[model samples]
Target: MEKTNNKHPKGLPYLFFTEMWERFGYYLILGIFVLYMIDPKDTGGLGFLDKTADDIFGTFIALTYLTPFLGGFLADRVLGYVKAIYIGGVLMAAGYIGVGLFQEMPLFYASLGLVILGNGFFKPSISTLLGNLYSEEPYKANKDAGYNIFYMGINIGALVCNFVAAYMRNKYGWGPAFITAGVGMLVGLVIFSVGMKHIRSANILKPAQEGDTKLSTVLLKVFVPAIVAGLIGWIIPGNIFGSDSTDAFIFACIPVVFFYVNLYIRANAEDKRPIGALLAIFAVSLMFWAVFKQNGTALTRWANYYTDRTAPAVLEKPLETLYLVEEKSYESKEVPIYDDQYRAEKNEAGETVKQEGKDIYFRNVTPERKAELEADPTKPVYLFNTELFQSVNPFWVIALTPVVVGFFMMLRRRGKEPSTPSKIVLGLFISALSCLVMVGAVWAGGNGLEKVSSWWLIAAYGVITVGELCLSPMGLSLVSKLSPPRLTALMMGGFFLSTSIGNKLSGVLASLWYGYEDKANFFWVNFGLLLLATGLGLSILKGLNKVMKEKGVQ
Candidate 1:
């Protein structure tokens, strides 16, 4: 066996920053997507109902992840990874710019199409490229660490982009925030181009193996049928799954899911066990994503309405200049109370009825805190942008990645590092534990009858981030490790397909937010889903561990 030094490949930083900027663009838009959609049309928003917004959000993210399957296949066979990434980045940027420039239904949908397509090509290729860079001797030993580092870079973009999003949206409007997202993606593309030299070695395209499935065959058999299924779901009379988009997404997934199942069925014995292990992991991960993805929909609602967002008077004006503060007056006025669909309730006079208050925000404040604020001359409540809370998870990732990496390193040095499968098992249980933190938040907040402290959100995000570190990057590393060289990119795409399913499920779950009159019940449902995932993960642990050992991957 050849022993090599443990220093990381030079390509790491370039991939790191490129992914960071791309995520910045992606997450920035996501941070404010629902908020913008639900805002009044007079405020430059689309005035969508909350359920509708959540549905759109879910569908968008699902499609975004789903396309990576094709992307990875194309990168492996047709376009080299680097070229695919560039194409993806450019398309995504154009989509974001289009979103900012045009808000009408046609252009909006077109832009979304661009982004969905762009993400398909860009996401898997770059990740596959990064995995390839670590395939050599010394770096192979450090693939997990490299992915952890890369994951940190992704969060760095996610962390900072929300502030940018908040500032741009607050100062200019929704359009500019979206435009900024486009610019960030362009910046990412430029950075990737600059570092092309470093990553050139990893851009090798895999020719079709003797038994490998051809791209043409895949497009005709998988994608073509998926489109037909999606169309059928869309045109079907009554909505079986909440809405047309939801039905279409679920319907479309059938073919893709079948394709993966077919992959397992047709796989040779040598590759079968690892593929099965990955498929099991993928199935359980749907629950993880269903819960984790709430950061955009359900969790954002908590930040916007349930949490106390008032800033100190001393920092109010300073924060205001940066567009960090959302200033609202506490004066009495008639405001619409949202219905189950988050639409304003209308009266028999054919006009929207209103109540004698701005929002339930004040009502949720405890008596003591309310009285204290009422006595103050500062009638204008200054709130930190709700989107800013989206940073908490990424912020935790950045702050804790070093610690996580160090802990694993310590274990490695002691010759006791857990196998990748074991780590994933631990991650699932830990993630399930994080949901309990939110359960506490609900109880502490008097079941949404009172505002909770920001510490609750921080704590929840911190716990989940730990689980994310253990599981997410490890999943990437596992796919790279277990996949046969010829099928590496394709398997990477499969990993993302799992994510797509989970993302769509997340939207399905989030759309039920209004259905839970008791907010505690909502968090409990999330907790239950994660617990189910954790149990499923535990049952498969021993088998997955055996497969990893068989594959000679720790």
Candidate 2:
């Protein structure tokens, strides 16, 4: 047996801070995005409708996670992990700053493109670097725990960034919040640059395996074909899908998807099973992502519209002083002030929609709250900004990570813990229940005709977070465990591919937000999707757990 330290490595701290700040910035931008868009142009947002926001939101995330495929491959082949990190970090900072500084619609779109491209370079490479660092003989035993800790760093950023984003968006407006995010990224870059010495050893790039195609070969055979095919998909005469952007993204994924197919086809028999299993997991998890990704889109809307977001008088002053709360006046008739920057077209009812001049934020708000604000003559009514809802998932992740990890450890000691696959199956099942919470929230809120308590959203997230803790960290650990040593980098790419696809589907699902008039029906739809994914996962759990046990890991 190898006599290694078997504890997590010194580099874990650096990686932790690196990811913490990186996600801090990334999630900050995301948390405030919808609010910024739907806010009145007079208030500094683009003021788009919910459908438009949903479309762009879906596409933005779709690209953000999708690019990791390109990023992972580039690192595995041409650019080493450190260089990829540097490139990605710089580009992302530039993109964040670009959005903050530019108010023009074209510029905003361009800025999004930069962020998308930059993330492809940034996300997967850093994760791959962490994996590489752990693969060193001395640290191999601790890789799973190390990855979980690293995942915690991501959630910490996610949890805290919302407050930072809320404060900036409410107090200084959207630009400042975005600029703050950009600054966070720059600080992350500086830290990573300073700690270059620590990670230098793990920066080693492996030579292509004997049967593996050369970098040039992949570029020629995969990259070029993808570009050509994607271009064709983009300019096709009519929209086969709902939006041109969706068409373009799907087209773009064709070559990338094909590349993975080739990898599986070409892989040795031993490698194939794990790759096949991962690919299968990735395929099924698309539904999970589609539902889970709604945290930002549909769920955010639920918080903004259906939830009673008023801060009580006792807590209001402190929050306002901290700039965590924003004040909107009913006297000013600040009916969300949805206009050109935030307008949506209405049907015969004159409701604000994604039609162009309407802010979708008003869609789910209980009519009672609306009437109360419209009729109030007393002190100005204050509503909590919608961005605050973004904190729930990460907050849950941070609060639950240690407990979940410890419980598993305790179970391991007693030989009663579930296998990683079983845990994931459990995770899927638990996550399914979160939707039920929302279904109840819908009814509780009187079918979205009245504002419900924020507790509904809180309770739902709390449920899903446990599932997330079980599934998400464990998925990363599973990849490290099952992937063959030689093809680890490529296989990690596969794992992210699953995530990327799921992320895209999440956007696709969100785009349908405008279609569902009854919000509870919308939530139930999400629930059903997760239920299907969960059932599929459990169906395979017997086999997956068998394989995991054979791998001789907990």
Could you say which candidate leads in TM-score? 1
Best candidate (score: lDDT): 1
* Local lDDT at 280 for model 1: 93
lDDT (Cα atoms) of all candidates against the true structure? 0.85, 0.76
In model 1, state the lDDT of residue 520. 75
Q: Residue by residue across 379-492, what tens digits does model 1's lDDT show?
A: 778788899999999889889888988999999999999998788877887887777888898899878778899999999999988988888878888998898776665677
Stretches off by above 4 angstroms in model 1 are: 1-12, 131-146, 197-202, 339-356
Q: What tens-digit string does per-residue lDDT give for candidate 2 at 1-554?
A: 12336476556678788889989989998887866766546556676666667777877887787678667778878899899988998888888988998978898989888888888988887877787788767778777778778888898899889888878877776788898888888888887877777677778787777866466765687668867877887899888777777777778778878887887898887777777677667666667777788888778877776688888878777787775665544343324334322234444433333322222334455666567655764545555777778888888887887898899889989989888878887888889899999989988867766668999999999998898888877777788888777666556666666776677667678767666667677778888888888888888877776666666766
Model 1 residue-pair collision total: 0
TM-score per candidate: 0.92, 0.88
